[model samples]
Target: MRKKAVRNQLWVPIIAMTLLIAGCGTKTEPMVDTAAGSKQQQSASPAPAPQTPVETVELTISAAASLTDALKEIQTVYQTKATSTKLNFNFGASGALQQQIEQGAPADLFLSAATKNMKTLVDNQLIDAGKQKNLLTNELVVVVPVDSKVSIGSEADLSKPEVLHVAIGIPESVPAGSYAKEALTYGKLWDSLQSRMVQGKDVRQVLQYIETGNADAGFVYKTDALTSNKVKIAFAVDPKSYQAVEYPIGIVKSTKHGKEAEDFYNYLQSKEALDVFVKFGFTVPK
Candidate 1:
């Protein structure tokens, strides 16, 4: 009976130990599987993509007022090729633009309506003379309001009594005005038409004077006249009467962004830029 009691105690201890070991094994298996699953998920995850930075550069241009339309279109078309570069334009009379540059107005490049203004800058050492190029030519013409009955078939007719008010740019600061002076002086009409003159700051303003009927006749570039439908070309001023109208473009020597300005200056000589300028009625140098 004593031996049987001792054997029963030993059996009870073995059964308790077996149950404890089985419980530990069941808990440990799930924990091991969960740890393995976490590592697998980490290893299988996709990597992040690399980053690419965009270039941020903006260029400024000081151009003749007549180039406004063509350059704007060039700016649009150039964006396809130069996606990171931006263009800012300062358009005004060529002489005025020249003065601004001489006075240190912010400009990366200069486009003048006349070679005379460009030569002045070149002489001032503000532009590299070697970099200057005459890119366009324009015809000076007489314009009238679309509804006018005036018969101005020639530059001589500008002195007619019936055409009382004639618009022109101010000669001291306007290249178009300087051209008109040259034409009238060539025809011996500049001295006679002064009392009836309506002056403008730029060719476009002269264009406005005709379009608004403030002046019975005005002289402007063919390109300027083409920009408006409210005015009609009464006649083309004889090319022999004035200096040939040329558009000279160059990069300013003081430009902060020389490379970008040069890229644009070069682009202006491209076929795409010529297309836009020709479409705007400017003559590209062959």
Candidate 2:
């Protein structure tokens, strides 16, 4: 009876040991599966999303040649502020630009040095009359080469014998030339100066003539004369001599980007743009 009792005690211990071993194996297998699942989830994480691009709109502006310097500065400011819109400028004589618009050239806006060109466009329905406004004013001036020795102090001096050739823009197309003609006519010197006049396609060309010494003197806007180191202002024509030198801006009737063009047009009247124009010798409209 003592031997049988000892055998029963040994069997109890063996059964307890077997049950513990089986529990450990089951728990370890589940732990290994859980660790593998965590690694797979980490490896399958998605990449960051791409950023959206900004939408950009481009506009074309047909402007008078005299606005070249001021508009270039304004363009820099506009681009910095209005990031979504880009301005492309087409600078030329207002009459030439008017003809181009009449011929169906692609332009979003028109900025004229004089109202006559604007009037022609308005008369032909090429511009939005409702959107038109005179933005600035300018003065007519006589310019001589930096090294000129002739005593030219007024429009009357342009007919002096020492002044061999005088440069002026074409009166039929360039507003500056038309103003020059009016000033000379007001002074009663038109016929006397006509024989010595050298005509250019635009005001810039007139300025170029004086700069290169191609002509003894030239007529240009005060703003145009201010841009050059090679020319000196010989005199400012009396305000009474010519009509008001007004600059008008308007939206084109055929512009596809009317909203953008209008926005830019309004921006030109802002203090920032006006400051630039003033720096370049343009006078703000009252």
Candidate 3:
């Protein structure tokens, strides 16, 4: 009886230990699973805060007719770098462009062919005067149709009898016209050529007249003359005869893309854009 009781006690302890081991073993996987689940929930439910969407800005630029090509080329480079920006350009006579801006056209940038127009904007506080920079300079040239046999050697050649029709931008509004008048007056031919002159609203219109053979000769920027393969350059007027054609660029005061606009204005003075302007017959302004 004593032996049997001792044997029974040993088996009781063994059975209790076995039950404890089994209980621990059965809970191990569930504990691990619960820990893993908690980690997953923490990772999956990160934060309720919303992320900001990338912004897109539209910048409107009112520029002189002469900068149409250069601006277009520059826009390509700008767009490639600033993928979220959209550049829209309105090219016209400097005076007209100023009028548009003054009349509440949504312009982020203003580029004038002459300082006179830029001054008009500055006087009205439409642009940030402090940000304005003189970017380029240009010279006036006389252009005739490629097939025209009109012999033109100098400003003196403009007064010939065969040069019946001459196209010029309206002197009051167009910077090119202002430059043309300055050249003609300095050469003492303004009065003589007045009778044969056809006035266009803008310099581009004058170019159109010559390109369509509507005029025997026309006065335009050297850059414009270089742009057309059909028009032959008769002569480049002496820079001394005309007021310097300096192009000034500035950011509009009310621009929505204020930061981006200034960035692009800075880019204009970059070597990449400057080299392109030089290739198209424009000189860097001093």
Candidate 4:
């Protein structure tokens, strides 16, 4: 009886231990790592900030035809500095240019060969008179074909019989022509040569006439005369005969890119641009 009781106790203890081991072996859910899970959730990408786009502004400059060569050089140098702005030039007679601006042409600035054109715009309120600057001075000269037989010493030489087609810019619109007329009138040679005159649209056109031999003699700015190898300056008209040939530049009142236009305006008046002007045979005023 004692051995049987001992065997029954041993069997009960062994069965209880086996059941505990099996319960441990049964499937169960693993503990969750809350800290690691929160870290993963926070590591998700954050919303990005909105960025403003930089825009390139195009500034339109209405300049006199005589300024072409200098401004072209200036354009090259300016692009290096103002990478954000693009320059667009509209070159013509100063009077014609101001008239266009008055009629709402798409111009940001007006660079006139003479002050009269600028005055028209100022009186009309298209440009602020106070903002204008007398940027340059020029001399009117008589030019002839490099290979011409004409002997021009002064305004009197233009009246010679061989000088048939004397080209001058249209006096009403072209500042160069106005200066020429004023100079010739002062010399008392205008009335006598009116029949032989071939009026051009601008000083450049007059230069072209002389270059192509369409005109025997023509009046042009000294700067224009230097641009062509086909024409030679005959003589410089007396500066005292006419109002000082001054170039005035001003910002248009209706510019959409006001800030950019002002920047370019300030650049033109800088030493770098003035150097280019001097290189092109233009005299920059102090």
Candidate 5:
């Protein structure tokens, strides 16, 4: 009976340890599986990538019609350096463009063919005075049709009674016309040729009249005369006869892209752009 009691005590202890180990093994298996699942979930998830910013800038430039070729060339050069920027150009008579700026058009830059139109903006405080700079110079010339026989030896030829329908830009609205008026006054033909004047909106328009043979003769800039193959250059007006026809550029006070506008303005003075200007028949500022 004592031996049986001893065996019963040993069996009870062994069974209790076996059941406890089994419970621990079951709990540890579930914990190991849960830890592995958490690691897999963390490894499978993806983090967000950083984003890149998009840069864009638009610059609007209002310039004279005569500058069409030169400015377009400059624009091509400018855009090459700053591919993210867009250039917008408004070409017309200086007086007309000045009026548009004065009316609060969104203009980042102003390039005028004449100082008079620039002065209009300066007087009104529409342009930054410190940012203004003279950029180019030009000379006026007389143009006639290729086959015309109007023997225009001097200013006196324009005063002949038969010289009817002489084309000139409207003196009040065009710089070329104002220069022509000064030339006429200095040559003593302003009064005699006043009645026969056929006024045009701009020098380019006056050139058109002569090219179409609708007018006997017209006054335009040497640069303007070079643009057309149909019109023959008769004579270049004396540069000393009138005030210097200087082209000026300035940053508008209302510019949203003032820094970029100034960048482009500085580029105009660079040698690369000046070469283009020279190729187009404009005298670059020294």
Candidate 6:
């Protein structure tokens, strides 16, 4: 009986140990599965998305100095509407700008005060011929200092001995000067006014000369004369006396911003831009 009791005790401890091992093994498997599920959930989560980039472009425009006032206002309106594109303007004599473009200057668009300058670019195929158009027209006039007593009533007065110095733009380059030459030649005053002439680089310079009293009288675009408070219109040249003064604009052929340049170019021909030009004393061409 003692041996049997001892054997029974041994069997009881063995069975209890086996039950404990089985419980621990089952719990461990569930714990491992739970940890694996958490890892799987973490691996299935999506990453953040990338952001979209903004579109932006810059265009450089070479325009005539005469268009300065109107363009300044137009630029403000354009920026308000076209927030992605920026306009950079280069204002100067149309002839000079043409030379710069011919020399490979980085210009996207060209606005000339006269068709002759535009022709130079077209002849060389520097501008997109199809995109070229006459945009505006202007009148030529004689002006004098506000305080001057000179009786410069007409184009003929420019020849009078009393008018010691008459300012005119250089005929070889300036459109205003070319107009002045045409009018003087047509009126039979070119030869007579030679000794009394003070040639200027551009129309604005002629206006300046008259305003500062450096010249007794000067010939300039009506628009340019209007900009100075110190100068007054003496007379308006008859339209028939000179070739029609037309302003033309075109896209430069080498421009990289073709779409943006075309957009701005078309915008300049819009009614809103035309209104601004007219307000600044420019006559929109038909």
Strongest candidate by TM-score = 2
Candidates in order, TM-scores: namely 0.85, 0.87, 0.82, 0.83, 0.81, 0.81
Model 5 sits at a Cα RMSD from the real structure of 7.2
Report, for every candidate in turn, its global Cα lDDT versus the true structure: 0.90, 0.93, 0.90, 0.92, 0.87, 0.90
Q: Show how many residue pairs clash in every candidate, following the order shown.
A: 0, 0, 0, 0, 0, 0
Candidate 6 residue spans exceeding 4 A from truth = 1-55
Could you tell me how far off, in angstroms, the CA of residue 12 lies in candidate 2 after the best superposition? 13
User: Cα RMSD (Å) per model?
Assistant: 4.9, 4.2, 5.6, 5.6, 7.2, 6.5
Q: At residue 130, give the lDDT of candidate 4.
A: 77
- In candidate 3, clashing pairs total 0
83-125 per-residue lDDT for model 1 (tens digits): 8889999988998999999999888899999998999999999
Residue-level lDDT for 173 in candidate 3? 84
lDDT: worst 10-residue window of model 4: 40-49
Write model 3 residue lDDT over 1-286, tens digit each, in one string.
9999999988998999999999888744434688888999999998788989878898889999988888899899889998988899998999888988999988999999999999888888988779897899999999999889889979898888898899999888899999999999999999988899999888888998999999999999999998888898998989999889999999989888789999889999999999989988899966
Which residue pairs overlap in candidate 3's backbone?
none
**Residue 251 in model 3: lDDT:** 92
Best by lDDT: 2
Runs of candidate 3 exceeding 4 Å displacement: 1-52
Q: Tens digit of lDDT per residue, candidate 5, span 19-136?
A: 9989888843343687888889888996667888768899999988888877887888788898888999998889999999999998999989899888889889999788888989
Candidate 1 is scored at a TM of 0.85
Segments in model 4 whose C-alpha atoms lie over 4 Å from true places: 1-52
Task: Say what the RMSD of model 1 is.
Answer: 4.9
Candidate 4: clashing pairs of residues: none
Ten-residue stretch with the least lDDT total in model 1: 24-33
